[model samples]
Target chain A: MRIAVVVFPGSNCDHDAYHAFKHVLGVETVFVWHKEADLRGADAVVLPGGFSYGDYLRAGAIASRSPVMDEVSRFAGKGGPVIGICNGFQILCEAGLLPGALMRNRGLRFICRDVFLRCETSGTAFTSRLSNGDVIRLHVAHGEGNYFATPETIVRLEAEQRIVFRYCDPTGRLDPEWNFNGSLEAIAGVLNEGRNVLGMMPHPERMAEAILGGTDGIAVLGSLLDYLESLPLKGGKRGEVAREAAGAAQKGAEGTKGASGREAGGRCKAV
Target chain B: MEETMKAKVTVSPRRGVRDPQGRAVLGSLHALGFPEVVDVRVGRFIELIIEPKGEGGPDEVEARRRQEQRLDEMCRRLLANTLIEDYRFETEP
Candidate 1:
């Protein structure tokens, strides 16, 4: 599938993300500068992690308002799939495309290391290839990976099955040490209301190859390709899906609908 | 007559980085027996003094406004890391 990786000043991972899709996944990938307002026919978009705008004024804050974000928002509004990793995740939170905010590490330090993530859902296009409760290894490098939300928002997220991934131990158990940045409820990642948009702290592109010590990230990227391939050859436009998803998300939030399968507030309860 | 002009600026986190200072301050407040502390993030407070120019001397209000604009440029270009900080300015005459 064709993909676009957004590039902003100080975004160091854009290249890696582009190469992973181009060389590893053997797909056409484009680098869209932050100043650009168009997606250029990309089927999906990835916001690579890095110290965007030098991590000034709160990571992702300045970058969130960059010109390209307006396009990203519009693209997602039309149902195009978008993924934000590391600092990109910070930008997404800053842009309000996803719920909750990312806070500083509970340890008060920048963390750069590999961590284990437990997949919490498999129903969406992002994780349709993986089974629920599957464990994957990926790299996380950030100081403010901790996620926070009001108690009510947390409950709503869980009830909606929006909590997609959580920090976990090697054996798939939730542990404090594995909870790298002390995210609220061990949250490592989450999905926007319609599940087409994903924001996660870990770098899946960094783990797409076995030579990189693992290939678990392949499934994540592969899932996108899987969805793209599943689309009908004719009369299947992406913009329609994104718009529908955006509408559904607004409705979901307005309705205060409960999560599909999980218990209320259970996903983010302190462990 | 003496005229005085001053500008005050503050810089803070944009929205994403975990504000450890804010959280720590909250924790400290709780430890200090103040349970009302919920959120806190450390930021910078800067004060600048501007002297009037010319025979009539600097217009306090005008000088303060000019200095405030300059301070904003400084924050966006240097003083504050825009990626992680947000800033504001106040002027006094």
Candidate 2:
């Protein structure tokens, strides 16, 4: 299947994503410029990592408003699968496609290291290949990867099982020290309400090839292909079934609805 | 009317949010024997020189209204991340 790698003005990982999907996975891939208004009909989309617009004002804040984001939002509104890594995750949150925000790292340092991520759920299209609680090692490189959201939103995400991954030790034990960033609930990755979009701080493409370092990322990429293959052609009886699955994944997003209604007290911040 | 205005925008992390830089400074102070320092929060400020929008100097009330509106838009859309930060602005003509 064809995959689209969106290249923002300052995105540096476009080539890496292209290599992972085109060489490792043997899939057709194209580099879609951030200025482009459409996806050109790709089966899947990947928002690669980088300092878009030099991360001026705030990380991912500027890039999220690029013209391409309009179509990206529409594509996500459908059942198309989307994966955002590192800075891409920040963009997703800024675009309102994902909940919460990425704050400064708790240690106030730009951390770059391999960390273990335990798959919290396999219910979404992004993690269907892995069983729950499976651990994968991925590289994380960023200064503002600490995720924060209201307590109510965290509870909703937990109840919906949308937290696809959490920081943990190799043996699958979640320890505070193991959390590279002070993300709430030690969240390493999360799925949107529809479960088709995933935002994670780790760079899976960096670990997708054995030559690079590891092959753990294969599972994550492989699962996307599997999920894509499982869906039938658009506008058919089989398509109806796939749509139903997507519908079930759109759990209630309380924060998105009550941003102004909720009092700002007690909401956790990174300090 | 044309008028030159200086606007100062202050952006700070919302309360209950983590401020690693602020915490680091606080630690440094404590280590330097400034134990009385209770708390410290780090933030950023931006100075903007707003150019005249029209031919002559605008009326005082109109200039203040325009400056405030522009500053709010700038903060909301670019200068600050509303999700995690709050911003306040003051202008002088």
Candidate 3:
């Protein structure tokens, strides 16, 4: 299937995503310029990370208004898979495609390093390849990656099980010190209410291969492909796949013998 | 009359949200022996001059009202993200 990588003026990870999808994953990939109105027939959309528009007026605020985002919004509305990594996550939130916001890191430093995450939900398009409570390592680099929302919004996110990932120790313990940016509730990523849009601080494209020091991220991308392939031949209607996936995830959570292991927290070295 | 309306906007992190930059500044102040400082919230200041669209037809009062409305819209749309920050503006008479 073809994937479209949306490129804003200052996007630095566009090529990394391109390489991962085109060469590593063997998926047809194309770059859609910020000025382009159409997505050029992409089945899925990835907004790669960078200080788009110099992070002017706040990170991702300006790029969120780019001409191409109009098309991205249209694509997302139809229940298409959209993954926004790092600054792209900021854009998604600013554009109202996702909830909450990414604020300055609590430590006031630009963090660039590896962190572990536990899969909180498997129903979303980006997490179908993972089991609930599976832990993986990914790299995050940003100055404004702290996630914040109203207490009520956080509660709603929890209740809906839209939290796709959360920061954790390598052994899968949910401790405050492992939260790289101090995101609220240790949230490392979240799915939109519709479950099609994913916004996360970590860069999966950066860790798609074993040579890059890890292959954990491929689980996320592979999950999207698997979800797309599993849909009815017609692709069904909006929310069809999401609904089925949620049911499957719920079943998986209930039937797995390892459910208690998840609660105990340690599975293995995350990466 | 394509008069230019001037405005000043201030944007800051909402209360109770962590302001790391402001906290860093606060730390520096404390190190400089300013224990009196108990809190800090870093923010942004922006100045905008809006020119009316092409020989506007509105009267002076109406034009000013429209300008104020546009300024508010600007703040809501771009100048501030109401989710994590708050914004206020002052316009020239």
For all the candidates, what are their Cα RMSDs to the real structure? Answer: 7.6, 6.7, 6.1
Ranking by lDDT: 3, 2, 1
What docking grade does candidate 3 earn?
high
What digit string (tens of lDDT, one per residue) describes model 1 on residues A1-271? 5799999999998988997889999999999999999888788899999999998757787898899999999888766789999899999988889887787888888998889999987756677667778999998889988898767878877877788899999988999988978898999888887566899999989998888878888878888777666554445665454345444644554455433321121121111
Q: What are the TM-scores, per candidate, against the unseen true structure?
A: 0.75, 0.87, 0.89
Candidate 2 chain B minimal-lDDT segment of 10 residues: B52-61
B6-90 per-residue lDDT for model 2 (tens digits):
8899999889888888889999999999999878889898999988676335476776677688779989987888878989998
lDDT of prediction 3: 0.83
Candidates, DockQ = 0.21, 0.72, 0.83
- Which regions of candidate 1 deviate over 4 angstroms? A236-271, B1-19, B22-41, B46-89
lDDT of 3 by residue, A1-271 (tens): 6789999999999999999999989988999999999987777899999999999989999999999999989878766779999999999999999999999887878999999999988745677678888999999999999999899999988876778899999999999999968899999898876566899999999999999989899999887777666654436442344334433443443455323212211111111
lDDT of 2 at A152: 91
Model 2 CA deviation exceeding 4 Å by range: A234-271, B55-63
Over the stretch B1-93, how does candidate 1's per-residue lDDT look in tens digits? 145667688888667556777877888899999997777878878777756544444565674456566678877755565545788877666
Q: If you assessed candidate 2 against the hidden native complex, which CAPRI class would it receive?
A: medium
lDDT of 3 by residue, B15-87 (tens): 8878888889999999999999999999999998777776446577787677778888998998999988899
The CA lDDT of each predicted structure is: 0.78, 0.81, 0.83
Give the TM-score comparing model 2 with the true structure, all chains together.
Answer: 0.87
